[model samples]
Target chain A: MTGFTTTESLAAYMPEQNIDTDAIYPARYLLLMEREGLGPYLFHDRRFHGDGTPKEGFILDLEPFSKAQVLVAGAGFGCGSSREQAVWALTGFGVRCVIAPSFGEIFAGNALKNGLLTIALPEEVVARIGAAAQRGARFRIDLEECILCVDNEIVATIDLPEGQRMALLNGWDETDVLLQEEGDAISGFETRHRMAQPWLFQGST
Target chain B: MGRTLYDKLWDSHVIRSYDDGSALLYVDRHLLHEVSTPQSFIAIEKKGRSVRRPDANLAVPDHVVSTTNRHLPIADPLARAQTQRLVENVARHKIPFIPLDDQRQGIVHVIGPEQGFTLPGITLACGDSHTSTHGAFGCLAFGIGASECGIVMATQAIRQQRTKTMRVNLVGLQSPFINAKDIALAFIARIGANGAAGHAVEYAGPVVAKMSMAERMTLCNMSIEAGARVGLIAPDDQTFDYLRGRPMAPKGEMFEHALTYWRTLPSDADAQFHRELTLDVSDVEPHVTWGTSPEDAAPIGARVPSPEDLTEATRRERRRRALAYMDLKPGDPLEAIAIDVVFIGSCTNSRIEDLRAAAAVVAGRHVAAHVKAIVVPGSGLVREQAEREGLAQTFLDAGFEWREPGCSMCVGMNGDRLEPGQRCASTSNRNFEGRQGVGGRTHLMSPAMAAAAAVTGRLTDVRKLMGGKP
Candidate 1:
């Protein structure tokens, strides 16, 4: 529900391709139910050992990276599971933006709803951002201007679909947006649909 | 030009199209499971909105339900609480629910089509990624997140972006002991994991045409593994026959009329596609994943790939990590890799046909001494049917546990998990790191291949066990 316009923060990079949702937030913690307080469980399997101790030299556990709000990750980031908790975990862990070459389609959609901006840049552009983040650069994500900056230098010009850009800028609840803008269209479609395809509604009522 | 099946389904369901290229798609069926619905229900309650079409939604507790001790309360407190919340939420919303103890209670994907809620030419959405399984019936089905689930619950529609269409033509001879799971993995390995990203892949050609509905579901179910949100097959006699006489399907004249429309649901011969691929399955042997991603798969005869062989830096790093996690040495033969567990269930390959295939492999043989194999049916009905057909007995006699229905070891949420460092030959969709359990190594394979692994104490070519060509 928080509007996202721009953020200048420490950036982190994880160069492993296909970092799936299960790794982001493992399935074992899924039963915790409530969406909040999932920060500790973010990358639970990767962050901790079997005895629940943090692994030494882990990138996120390191200084500066622990406070990172921007992540420049490898290709196919968040590429498994439809668990919205992955987004919840990322935002909870203070990651406001993720720049990757590609993302799991479902995870990308989920990220939009949660205000965690996902920017799918070209592979080379993502690599450049990852390199910058590895050098401890502070990145600025300007959603309104559609550009990403590192150390005050524009690294890549970002482009987002207009509707997504509007939603993120204003923090619009999609359900409310639909009802307010296209309520009549929904009702009319339902009425016309039932009459045209009566068999689809044969026994449900 | 002619239209694609996706275009037809999308056009029929669109309430309105936005200039940004996304459309408000009317959801005809919405499947819900315990794990994904809690937040959606909370969001809807906070918004002071009620379900607009409760009749269109079906709820079940699958992810957290214990496969063992079905009549008893859930053992894990957190899991129990989550399942209980679904019962309360669905009761309040008046959504039709299949209780955990119901014979029909199973993975949402399995039960939807089984109950006829997944009819062709409809737009179906679920909170789980495997919702693409319903697309096998020529439906516009794909997964949505919790917020979209909330929107669908309240408004019965979702704002969805248009997807490029792809036709994956399945060519080549149908190999023995090769199921749709193998074909899925084979093509995914060839195309990499994100092969069909942003595209709705439609499986076609003679090989696909000869597949059964269950096999078609297996292929579509793994569409997500290939980065495809939706996978489809043209509705044919096989699809209609599978749906006929089902509880919720149309009846009498209604069925006839539905068929008339469904007949026109396939992509026209001259339909345009954004991409096209031809998979020759004649060379697609039984595939087992050697690494974390589904794309890191190879045939049973192949050896583990060395990271040094990869030219790309990121791919090399991924393989190095996968090999370390799997405890597999580079150049190790895949068939010789030992497994400690054999899981023969999941929404991917837990249908009656899948059960029968595994049962046939383990009928007269016994499970290896070191392997702990289990057969968890997809649904309670599937379990009962397997029992009537004596497949359950065969598995039991083979030293395998015949358990109740639900996603057991696949997601590992129901107290069915592998210990750290355990290796499993599983018939599940994913081989992601720690997917079955923390530090667990999973080799994704077909049910028959898993059965072969169970009997041999290692990954074995399933054809050798079946007395066929190896």
Candidate 2:
């Protein structure tokens, strides 16, 4: 997990809402345990035709957009399914940040865990970014300042929760937080809770 | 201030809170499945950490296992490896496991409730999105990713921020043909896919309160499709009755004690919600999705919506893409849209009640010669119950393939899949492109609707076929 601070790249625009995990990476490819090499499989069904040839007009295949490391999308960007493979596929495809009006809760969490920054802006701002991306404009997302910029002009100031922002900035996994705990407090709480509610742990133990 | 059900649940589970509004919350039950657990187990082994609370975890292999022939080995190497990995990890950690051949072995969500593993006034987590299905018992259940699953496996706690509460009050008398699946679909269609995003929905009002436990499960099962992390129904007599004699339920005196606690799990009378919406289901027909998203749904008699009907340019573009992928036209009626296959099973609608509903529609009727229909129960217990009641024979006699329990055609991971250019009426939750198979088109609907589609060789209205006025 590499800490993310800033990235400037050509923005890829996918203007569809509810772009679900199935569309991100289809269920057929979910059998593999190894998460690597998923970039080519991202949107495989939509990006290619039945004969194993790339579709001619897909945005990812177009010039300039092919090198995009930032994605601008509509609302509900990663809805449906809790597959972490969707985040791995996006990161594997070199997308370091996703800008959307909103995102599916689980997908957003998965993205944060994988060090992929998910920025939620106002709908109008996202639409503007989408329009600008269509005109081949490069955009930058600065996590430290919580600002999105195009051509050195600040376009939108995004607000991310402090905890998530720090997690991405420090590349801190949840395990790292857990390891910081001394376990004495947790054990003390558990003992008191068990004594108070003995019935709760009856079947569990 | 009166707290909502979600607030009460969250407040009870908080072990410690941080300034960032996130809390370390205790998890009462953890459900594990094959596809999501392998990576988490590997990560734990790499960290040299053992499962902290094996007693709180229950493991099963359902996603990749073959739904046909229980005695045979899984043919797909990847699926076989995943199932084997789960078995090995569970044995190594001494977690409670239900093997494939066990009568109790079933879909994770199905087995949890049936075995008394999922109860009210507790918090549950699983690696699959449909974990919300267990919320039918008034539990705060939601899905988690692989890493989060690993955390829960190690600490029996999850870090989380509380979500706002949304109350969806279904206010009308539902028709007999309009089952819980129809209610869920109609609600999604009205609210759109992202309508409930960032909120926990508590279903109330006359329609929801009247539904059976199975029906309530059906309603909560598709909450993920609506972008809701959790969906709940207050515990009532139906929920308690359903869990009374289950194998894992509490014994005599303990049962009475548990019931006293369960009765107190409902939201207070004057509880306030962050958002409230009421839907009148008096005239909702048996609903089905005509396009890729669950929100792109309509009554069985309606035609597909045109891109022109959409006000937003992005939505119009999405509709155009969906139309091109589905090979469907704007004016084409949802009914009489010929389907190549009919799949009547998934976590959404594979319980015993769902099977009985489908069997009733196909009791003496034969399937269309051109259609391929299959019925996969949700669990081994469901399969046994169906067999005992002769529902399996009814399906087999109607030319529907009666198979064992697993997530078969709902997801195309297993051998069950549709070929290119094939269209299907599926009882599964998702209808995204290639969800059933690569290049496969799926129309989400209820079991009864799928059964009627199988018999008519097209998407037909179940009511019309049942001798009701169209």
Candidate 3:
């Protein structure tokens, strides 16, 4: 996962709420078993017509927005399905940060795991960003400062849980986080737990 | 201070609390399916990590297994590879696995509770989102992503943040025509798709207490569709009775001991919730999604909502997009919409009870000539039970194809899919675009509703088909 501290980029505005995983990357494309090259499939059903032609009116197909690195979406973005492909698709499309009023819980976790920053701001502030993005404005998201800025003015100060913030800032793999714990303590707890609840380990052998 | 059932369950599973407000929580049981775990197993192998407690985990190949015929080998190259990978990974790691040929093989969520792996007062994790189905047994069960699956497999614990609790009181007696799926769809429609975004929902009140364990599972299964990670109902006699004498359940004296523990697993009288809402199910008619999102649902007889009905411009625009994608028009009656297929199976509503309900509707009635109706049982056990009760014969007699168990047509990865522009009345939880297949439009409904649609060749209200007023 790429570590993130800050990025300043133009925002691609998607005003629709409940932009589900199925829309982000449709199920048909999920059989490949690999997450690579999913960016083209992002919003495939919505962005393309049945004849395989691009829908020019779709937000991602418009000028300037096609190369956007920030996605300013409406409330409840990524609200359906548990597929991590959704985050992968966004990152594949070069969307480094997603700014929404709120996000689905699982989608947010998956975003953090994949190094995509998900920033939750007040609905009013997000609406303002949506308005600004419509006018081709650019914004910067600083993870260390927990703030979003446009033209040197703070747009919103976001709230991030300490664990997620540090994980993003350091690009810490979960396995590394667990490995940092004291080995003796983990083994000691395991030994005691196995002894106390032998039935719990009945079928392992 | 009174604690809700979710609080009690979470508190009991806490292995260690961290200064950063996250905790290492013990997972009592972990369920795995093919699509989600292949990447996790690959990651574990790359890291050279062995599963910490293989006994605590169970693996099955459901998502990619072909549901058409269990006797034949999987024909799709990708599906076969996924199933083979899962089998090899489970064998190498020494985890208990249910092969596709095994009688116990089924959807991970269905097999967990049916095989007695899901018990009261435990913390369950699965890579799939519908793991909330286990919460029906009074457990703290929720979904996890691929990364979390690898973490739990390697360490038997997951670091988590405590979630706020929301209590949804379903007050009043429900109509007999209203099955649990209707109730869940109604709830999701009432609270928009993201209503429970970050909370664990506890279904309480009179209507919930009266529901059977299977119905409770149906209700909890759709928590994901509403953006909730966990949904639970406290265990009672219904739960204990459902678990007694199962293959994996504890024997006589131990069962009694377990019962005593389960008896103590309800929310306290004065438990506080961060948010509380009451839904009266007494008048909730059968619901069907008219658009891509689950929240875009209306009663069976209601007209499709136009974007003009929405006050917010964003919402209105979304409605217009959804309407265009679904190929629906404003004021179109839901019942008047025709369907090309009717799928009666998924983790959501494919249990024995669900089969019986659909069977009753289509017992002597033949499916309309133009509709392709298929009934895929949730698991082999469910299929066996349905066959023993002659439900399979009833469905077959009614021209509905009776198939083997797997997640057929639910996610459409295993070669069961609809042709482009085909509409389906599905019992699966999701109604997202292409959920059943590419360019396939889905209308989520109950099993009976789906069966009724099959017989009528359109979206007909089950109540109306039963000679009752719509």
Candidate 4:
């Protein structure tokens, strides 16, 4: 995963709310083992015809927005399924960041691990950005400053937890980070937990 | 000052809390299915790490396995490889696996509780969004991504930010026709899709208290549809009675000891919640989704909503798109809408109770000649139990195909899919576009409701078919 510091890119807006993971990456392609090159299948039904031709009028299929690396989406983006391929497809399609009013809990967590920045702003702020995005506006998301900028003017402030911010800025492997800091703590907890609930360990396997 | 069930579960599992407000949580159980484990297993092997608690993990191949002819090889090479990868990964890690042929093999969510792997007050994690199904046992269960799966396998711990609590109190007597599936859909419709976003929802009150373990699991399974990661009903006598003789539950003295702890798992009377909503189940009717999103649901008797009724542009546009995708128009009666297929299975509603419900509606009745209906039990055990009870025979007699245990038409991952433009009445948790097939239109409803649709070839009120006693 690449460390995220700042990125300025054209934003594509999706006006639909509750854009579920199933719609993002269809269930049929779930068996594909390889994560890369999933861009072709992103929004397969909505973006392409059965003949595999790109559908006209789709924001991602249209020029300018086709190259967009930032997506300004609706509320509750990525709301269904825990398929990480949804994130993989977005990243593979060159999307580096997504700004929405809210996100599915599992989708947001998956986004961070794949180096896709997900910023949850208030609904009004997200709407403002989305409005600018529809007009082919280019936005800059500054992780270091935790602000969203359009035309060098601050439009919204991004409030990410410090740990998430640090993790993004440094590309920290979460398992390594957890093991390095809380390895002993986890061990201690397990010892006490086992003692407290011996039934949990009683020959279940 | 009292603690909610979520608070109790969270406090018990915390290994350490970081200044950033994220806590390291130790997971007591991790369930793995084929689709989500391959990438995690590869990541762990690359990192030179081994599963920290092999015994804490269980693996099953459900998502991509062929639901028919389990003895024959899987025809789709890609799906076959995915299932094969799970087998190899589990064997290498020594994780307990329920292979496709095992009678215990089923949807991870259904079998978790069935085997007593899901217990009250323990934290469980899975790579599927429906992991919240286990929360019916009062566990702090939630879904994780593949990377988080690797973290759990490597360290037996996951970093999580605390979620505020939401208490959904079902306050009135439920109508006979309104099952947990209706309650789930009703709740999602009341609260938009993101109603419970970032909050842990504890289902409480008389309605939830009276629901069976299967019904509670069905309700909690769809909690993710409302955007809640965790959905719990505090463990009660129903939970204990369900787990008493399960294969993995504590035995004898150990069971007694566990019971003492389990008895304390419910929220206190004065427990505080960040958000609270009281719903009167007496007024709720059998619900079915008319649009793509679960929130786009209404009573089976209602008409399709007009997008113009929505004031907000985004919401209006969403409604328009959903209507267009579903081929539905404003003022169209939901019950009059015809369906091409009926599916009565999935982790959400494939338990034996669900089958019995469908079978009761199907007994001595034939499926509509034009409709293709199928019943896929959640597990082999469930399949056996249903067969023993003659529910399988009843479905077969009704012209519904009785298939093996797997996530069949719900996901359509194993080649059991609807053709393009086909409409279906499904008991699955999700009704998203292309969820069952590329161009399939899904109307999410209860199993009995789906069975009614099969018999009528249209979305009909199950209560009418049940002779007014659903």
Candidate 5:
């Protein structure tokens, strides 16, 4: 993994509402042996024509957006399905941050865990983010600072839970929760299971 | 001290809470699919962690793979690979799996309930939003993120916050034609989409009691549309009887003991609730959504809401936005809205009964030339049963496509999608913009209503369409 965070903004353009994980990465791509090659195929089935020609009119095919590192989107931008591949696809497509008016409840959780930033602005601010992208304004986000810098002006401030913030900063996964407990939980679970509810673990084949 | 469902469920599972808010939730069941598990298992390999609860977890390949002949090669290479990864991962981890071609292979939500693995009074988490459908058995089920899925896989526990408890009392019985889908839509119309936010909803009352298990499941499945984490119905004889003799259900004495325990899991009469809502069965009619979001729904008799009538700041804004995207006019009769497509399927409303109900509407009538209608089964079993009853042929004769399952057009996961600017009458849950494909508009309705739309190519009352049909 690269040690440095890329400071570029990705022009994440989507038609409004319920942008599902399947569109982010089609189920067909799930066959790929590795996550490494999934980025280019992100929205491949949609953005590419049936004959494999690029859909010239599609938003992701436009210049700068094709290279966008940050995405600004509309309401419920990631709703419907709970596939975390949506998060991986966005991240793999070089989007470090996604600014949407609203996010699907589960998709936001996925983005939080996978070191991607999902910022919730009001509908007005979401439009402004997209506008800022179109105008080629420098939209710099300070994940630790909670500030979205657009054209050197602080356009938005977002808040995340401090623990999630720390996890995102360090790319920590679920095991970090257990590691934080420092080996106390297992013994405590055994004691609790044995003493109070021995029957829970009583079954045997 | 708070007794929100989040707390009750949390307290039972917490090993301990750190200085932070998160704690380990003892996940009773973990259901996975081909798509999410491959990367997680890879992540597990990278971490050298073995799955802790292989017995408690289950995996299946539903999304991406075609539901056509099992022996036929998957046309989509990526789907084939993900499915293979899942198969190998299950084999390596020794977790039980229902692979393609397996009799039990279906959408995870459908397979789990039919197999009786989704039981009462237990916590169920899957990497799919429709996991909430399992709540019909009185279990608290919701979709957990993939990271949480991995957490559950490695330790059989994940951190959590809980939801407040809410009761949706469904009083009285519906007329012969009324159904659980109508009641569920009525609930959304009354409460609004975010009405039950951060709540665990329980559906009760005589209307609920009269509902078949499939009907109850349809109601519980859409609780997420109301922003509830989980929706539950009390475990009753109906639930117990449904569980008896199922392949995965407890055997002999174990079954009797489990039934007794499950019967005890219902909310006691004296139990207090944080929030309560009541809906008269007589109040609900065949339902559909005219605008975006599940909440923008109304009964068949109601007209589309004008923005001026939505005086609430949030609603006014939402209504205005919905009007723009849906191209719907205020005061337009929701019944008058023409539909280009009618889709019948999804984890929400694709059981055999839904098919039979839809078939009853479309049996003698041919679909309007302008309407493109399709029916997808929720599982292979449903597809087989639907065929055995000649329901598929009825649909086919009525000019509707009889397609394979796997959440088809419900989320537009596969190639089956509504074209841009197409308006559809759908039996799936959400009506949020682009839910069934980009630029596609959905008017959520019952299966019968969808069938009516298929015949007339518009949102017509199903009862009227039922006039001549058997």
Candidate 6:
């Protein structure tokens, strides 16, 4: 399990809210039938024209800002369906962390599982960070301290439950978690079911 | 401190908690559909296991077949195979099967509740995501993977985890013309998607009690949007009354006993929950998804939001991305935005009530010449009932194509699809790109709203089509 750490550089940001899976990866790209090509189409509809030419005034396509990773957004973030493709698209597009007032319940799961650190700050703090990003403020998020610290100053504290923090920091997928407890679960099921269903296991291997 | 519907169901299902964090929970009812059962059926075949408690399992074929021509061969080979496999598996398992031509045939979620099977204080699992629709009846319903479905088939149960209870309380009577779908959209958009993941959400408050059973189903159908496994509304007198006389419902003295138990299913007011979210239904209006996600919605009369208004990380990025995909100029009125197609079907809003809502709009009017419009009912029974009531003819007379039951254009996969760059107003569960077919943009809305889109070639307030609000 890799530590869920981020290299937050001091950079100002582009802002928007209510982002959805389709915008992250358009349907045309999903036709590729593989998760690998998905990243290229991340914001493809928003950043480029039908002919693949760059669209001017697009927030993601803007210089310096285009390279920026951390984003500050409004409350109720990741507010969409259970499509984990959105997270894959975001991480594939190079976003390492998201700072929002609140993250969408499913998107948070997808993000945390994929090593995308979600920083939930208070609404006022989120607004301040947005303003700072609008003015091109750059900073790095420290997963260990759980803060979005900017050039020798702390911008915001991000709170994740200790368990989730550990899961992210250690890259624990559902398979990994299941495997960790498989032995105990199987043994307990057998021992408990024997008494309840003695006839069913009379000749079990 | 009131107990939420989810808490009650979860407590009732506990067989034993395991040390490894999962629990052995008893399943009261198990629902199966075609899309996710084939692999499970194959697995069971390999294991030489017969479906345990076949009487407790119910099977319906939805999600893949076309509603365009029920009698005709399923044009898509993949869908045809899936439908065929469903028949074979269910027959072998000896469960009650509802095929396409059967009067009971419909979307699994619709049939689950309408057939008087989805009861309160029960746990149900189906392969389809929209199975959450059963939550309207106080059932703890959720989607499961194919492997889990196989387990449920062979053993009549699966290990389950207790869920945190999240209470969603609505306040005030909804504004005029605002329906349950509007309130649901508003709730998801308010909390953002994923607000209720890992939690069982209970729909409460006076506004919920005011809703009809079908309306409650519509509100609960979008539970996935909130990241909740299911959305539940406790059974009240209204619920019992709706179920008491149904064809499959318990009758006479047995019905009375069922009612006594059903009434007790609601939590006694002092029940506690892990979390609570509240909303005032009066503030909700005709809503539209401005962006690609269901949560990116705004009131129909509102303007497309600019990125400056967004203060969160992924949200800002999402808005920027949605604007790009939609090719919308900021500040554009959502209602005025033109659409190319209008699809009125899906497990979400394709019930008989939805057909009635849409028929009210198209009865006296023709669809827009440029908008390719169609009305697909959710079930064969709904289709027959609509025909008997002249609803189908009314839609056809309004220049809207009428179709049979199947998940048409909702998730593509079947013959139905939209041309690239064409935008549609759909009553389906999602508005994701290509979700209806590649490059097609879906704007999720209610049936009446879809009818309005069909009539106007743009998103319009359904009140305009109603001639006045109902």
Better of 5 and 6 by lDDT: 5
Best by DockQ: 4
Q: Where's the lowest-lDDT run of ten residues in candidate 3 chain A?
A: A193-202
Model 4: DockQ vs. true structure: 0.80
Each model's chain A TM-score = 0.97, 0.93, 0.92, 0.96, 0.85, 0.82
> Compared with the true structure, what per-residue lDDT tens digits does model 3 show for residues B284-383?
9998899988888889989999899889999999899889878999999999999999999999999999999999999889999999999999999999
TM-score of decoy 2? 0.98
Ranking by lDDT: 1, 4, 2, 3, 5, 6
Kindly report the fnat of each predicted structure, to 2 decimals: 0.75, 0.61, 0.57, 0.86, 0.33, 0.16
Q: What does the TM-score come to for chain B in model 2?
A: 0.99
Which scores better on TM-score, 3 or 5?
3
Runs of candidate 1 with Cα error greater than 4 angstroms are: A203-205
Give the per-residue Cα lDDT of candidate 6 at B201.
Answer: 82
User: In order, what DockQ does each candidate have?
Assistant: 0.79, 0.66, 0.60, 0.80, 0.27, 0.13
- Summing lDDT over every window of 10 consecutive residues in candidate 5 chain B, give the lowest-scoring window: B1-10
Assign candidate 6 its CAPRI class: incorrect
In candidate 1, what are the lDDT values of residues B216-254, reduced to their tens digit? 999999999999999999999999999999988998889
Who wins the lDDT comparison?
Answer: 1
TM-scores for all candidates: the values are 0.99, 0.98, 0.97, 0.99, 0.82, 0.75
Listed per candidate, the RMSD to the true structure in angstroms reads 0.9, 1.4, 1.7, 1.2, 4.7, 6.7
Ranking by DockQ: 4, 1, 2, 3, 5, 6
How high is the CA lDDT of each candidate model? 0.92, 0.88, 0.87, 0.91, 0.76, 0.72
| Sort by TM-score, top down from the best | 1, 4, 2, 3, 5, 6
Candidate that beats the other on TM-score, 1 or 2, i.e. the better one: 1
**Clashing residue pairs, candidate 1?**
none
lDDT of 5 by residue, A110-202 (tens): 787777888888787878767767777777888767788887888888676666666677675657556456336744664574444332232
Tens digit of per-residue lDDT, candidate 4, span A46-70 = 9888778877799998878999989
Itemize residue pairs with steric clashes in candidate 2.
none
lDDT of 6 by residue, B404-441 (tens): 77777886656677877889998887776556766677
Q: Residue B196 lDDT in model 2?
A: 95
For candidate 2, give the lDDT of residue B335.
89
